[model samples]
Target: MIHTISALVKNRPGVLAEMAGRFGSSQVNIRSISCGETENPEVSRMVISVEADDDAVTAITSDMESLDVVIQVDDLGRKEFVDRELVLAKLTMDRETTTQLMQIFEVFRAHVVGMGQETITVELSGDQERVDGFIQMVAPFGIRSLCRSGRIALKRGDD
Candidate 1:
């Protein structure tokens, strides 16, 4: 099963590395990660996804709690949340193609961030599946480079 763990860690050198290493050593395969800065400069929020069993989840959570840098751990289990990802892509652009892509981008709420002689940079943000689907739709356009910020989630609430 997949578990999303939210960690509050002191923003000190090597802390992120330590937490990542700890999970890796425990055989937890990290699938995605995202972090949010906190009001205190010395503390930050880290959200990580790992694949493991119930026993492994408890063991890893306990070990994480013992770390000096870690101040809290919230288990974002299999439900009750809305999650999203962000993706930035540099794509080859041409006059004929750019117009078509512009229309597609509008539907996805993506923006053209830059235009070079042969390429244009586009930014898209949305749920993981939507972002992945967008990538596939634009694959024929020739992707120059891309970066993705992994799944970030918050508990769902009544409207």
Candidate 2:
């Protein structure tokens, strides 16, 4: 199963590396990780995703919690949460297909962020499934470059 784990840690240089090392030492392979400043400037929130069994999840959670920099850890895999990823794709295009490409973009709710003589850059932010679907549908357009942000999530409902 894929698990989403959130860690609140002291904001400082090397903190990210330290957390990553901890996970590495524990034999936990992180599928994705994203960290950013939160409301409290002194602390940052790290959202990590991993695919592991129940035992592995327990071990990884315990390992993260034992870190000094980590103030708290929450397993959001089973909880109600909203997650998203951002993807930017640059595609080769021609005048003939411009209208068709725009229609596809509209269908996927993605927008053209940039346009060049022979390329179009599009940006889309959505859950994993939606993003993947968009990429698959746009592949025929000849993708030149693509970049994606690590998945980030927050628990649903009021705290």
Which candidate ranks first by lDDT, i.e. highest? 2
- Against the reference, the lDDT scores of all candidates come to 0.86, 0.90
Per-residue lDDT for 1-159 in model 1, tens only?
888888889888888889888889998899987777788887888888888898888898899999888998878784487778889999999988988788879989998889999898999999877999899989899999999998887667862
True-structure lDDT of candidate 1: 0.86
- Lowest lDDT sum, 10 consecutive residues, model 1, at 150-159
> Which residue pairs clash in candidate 2?
none
Residue-pair clashes per prediction, in order, are 0, 0
Worst 10 residues of 2 by lDDT: 19-28
The TM-score measured for candidate 2 stands at: 0.95
Query: Could you tell me how far off, in angstroms, the CA of residue 83 lies in candidate 2 after the best superposition?
Result: 0.4
RMSD of 2: 1.1
Error of 2 at 57 (Å): 1.6
